[model samples]
Target: MASRSTLLKLTFVVAMVLAVVVLPPPADAAISCSQVLGYLRPCIGYVTGSVPGKVPPAVCCTGIKSLNSAAKVTPDRQAVCRCLKQLANGFGSGPVNRAGAVPGKCGVNIPFKISLSTDCSKVR
Candidate 1:
């Protein structure tokens, strides 16, 4: 008993709703280790203990939190782990060890250990 115009409007509304429901969500941008490193670089002095008695700054903890969130995917996590390992190797053992402790110090619980010799391939 509906008029043609009303039926057409109803059909259009239903179609629009269905399309919205059926369409796949937009994909998230891929995270890269370089991006993660960029965030962490500001915290280097604190992490490496280069500045004696210096605790990590607020920016450092913010960067740590961002990296932790970004590396949620397995691939991103592994990439970050490898990058961290390479970065650790560039410093000597003492600094590298200190660097590994940054995440915990910042209260970020990354899944894998951060070490110069960490096997990134084993990170999950």
Candidate 2:
């Protein structure tokens, strides 16, 4: 039977410990669509800069597929590709979007105008 104040203090301390010890997403965890979108945000500038040019490097595509299989093979793959294509075309760089275009790590090849761009900076 702890007092209310004591129980509250204990709760707070436990919460603080959990906050410090609890981990974020694993390095190899599957990323949600929203997370993927966030990761690709900054790369927009980098990609748009190269509009009307060759697509982004294969490394970019490889990295994306490696990070999230959903980005490449899942039924949502097309949505991801389409979203990226729109972003590339809108940004005026057909190439950067192409950089993200490629088969997913699971071997699902996305066939569209160009592949999506992948920026891993958001992944911790």
Candidate 3:
């Protein structure tokens, strides 16, 4: 017969193996920037000033609202702010200024300014 200590060690090892195999992997704690961008893509025309009207469409506001809702945590909010800054850089100053104004125009209360100069790391 196995010694008590030996049996205990074997039981611990089996339990650990079982836990690894049976338990699901932990879910990601933060949302990806790509996902946030996907939601905001529809607002590009309005944000860029490419569209004739200054007013953003209802769909654009919906997307902004959805993005606002998803970025609940500090990390997620920071990620979103970084992504927006990147997008602003890609859009150039003219469009970026307009883009920054989009949230307020749509009545969406964003935590950080969506400007190219925004320091995303400092976003709360």
Which residue pairs of candidate 3 clash?
Answer: none
* 42-69: candidate 3 lDDT, tens digit per residue: 8998877776686888888899999999
| Rank ordering of all candidates by lDDT, starting from the highest | 3, 1, 2
Candidate 1 C-alpha lDDT tens digits along 48-122: 776666467878889989888878877788888877877777788888777777788889898988776678888
lDDT of each: 0.81, 0.50, 0.85
* Model 1 segments more than 4 A misplaced: 1-30
Clashing pairs in 1: none
Candidate with maximal lDDT: 3
Best by TM-score: 3
Candidate 3 positional error at 35, Å? 0.7
Score candidate 3 by lDDT. Answer: 0.85
Compose the digit string of candidate 2's lDDT tens values, residues 14-113: 9988987895744443435566566455344435554333444444454455545545444445455445555555444444533443333224454443
| Root-mean-square deviation of every model | 4.6, 9.9, 4.7
TM-score of each: 0.70, 0.35, 0.77
